[model samples]
Target: MTQDGYYAVQLNSIEIPGEFDISFLTRTSNLKAGNIIFDSGTVMTMLDTDVVDELVRELTDFVSLPTEKPVAPHFKLCFAVRSTEQEEELPALWFGFNGQSGNLRVGPDKLFVWVSRFVKCLVITGTNDKVQVFGHITQQNFLVGHDLEKMELSIIEKDCTKLHEP
Candidate 1:
């Protein structure tokens, strides 16, 4: 319940299988500002190109290498087109993070919405095979934990920069 809308989640070990080549994520409009984030990102995702390289080399434990053909990474933008009705007026918005994109696409959707808007996103590409999870749109504000006997993740919705680590 912080200003950035952060919540407590168990940072358990997760395994994304076949994490190679390109990753894909589906962003769409129709999301409300008062609604929860990252609510529609439980499916496969894609990364642009440069974002992929940086993400792999820094964020997670992945390997980067030289390639014959390099690609520039991009991001995704999703929104909604509100109308008068709900089902009869489903106005959705989703577009690739490519810098050259214009209007929202309308046709056979490319991805699904299973991600909440509560986490920072980055494009991660490993081995230059396929791009994956570029980055979410949200940023990770702060995470406070205690390691007395077990790891405990709590919700700290306040200002606490005086306790930052160097």
Candidate 2:
């Protein structure tokens, strides 16, 4: 485990669909890398840029909102993603996190929601290894749960307004 305590799990043959399904493998760090390289806190789960691209196309007219944190350039999408499970969608949800000042805050100001269905990534020079990242997307979407022993992420569907914020 890295400093933050994320267990590197390798998922293979994952299917990402938006009418057309793409098969690929994925890795996460929650931080940049890990003990050997770029690392941060645990509970790292990231989606590919290809997933982000798909969301942009499928979820047309997505309202772009301004963010205080400068994780990525340009505006971020402020909405939660859901599978067409049934007639009713999940409720709103928020990710509660300690701010830079150690104070907790929540919503359009604190977090932005993004889905894997809206991302795309191509080959960049020297990037023949694999596309991977800790990501602002994961940080914005999940709430880390730790008991000084085990760490896990739970899905919240309270408001689903943005990410985690009041």
Candidate 3:
């Protein structure tokens, strides 16, 4: 846990690639590695403002959907989807950490949340100066573990619901 009470991890890079084309966006090469906190208490992921802006711009260009002002104050990008079916075409995101751990590939199901029957908003947002927070929405379906003795964190792909089944 960090001094601020959030469980933070060192991040190496964040990348978003076109689902079917060549356009891509990446934020890496930080002079000092950035910290990304995994916060279960928060509902959406928060990244540095510049990173978020670039990501939003790239996604907007790729999808090209008519935009609507976000009803929620925290959301900056919200699109009007005719149906949930439209979500199938959004771009894919890859989050890479600083160690030997593999990259996390995020699909639309984990990346967006339905605001209403017609609106589905991306769960990622921007922060001004705080370390990035990886919220619960993006952590779904994974079995996460922390080891204080070793000062290590481990995340494994698992069906969390069945963890305690007989």
Q: Could you tell me every candidate's TM-score relative to the true structure?
A: 0.20, 0.29, 0.81
For every candidate in turn, the CA RMSD to the true structure comes to 18.3, 12.2, 3.9
lDDT of 2 by residue, 29-58 (tens): 243432111113422323355544453343
Candidate 3 lDDT trough over 10 residues, lowest sum: 20-29
Q: What is the Cα-based lDDT of residue 17 in candidate 3?
A: 41
Q: Write the per-residue lDDT of candidate 1 for residues 34-62, one digit (tens) a residue.
A: 11122124222333344334434432333
Q: Which stretches of candidate 1 lie over 4 Å from their true place?
A: 1-74, 78-140, 160-166
Superposed model 3: Cα runs more than 4 Å off: 1-5, 17-34
lDDT of every model, 2 decimals: 0.26, 0.30, 0.70
Please report the candidate that would top lDDT against the real structure.
3
Q: Given candidate 2, what's the lDDT at residue 83?
A: 36
Q: Count the backbone clashes (under 3 Å) in each candidate.
A: 47, 27, 0
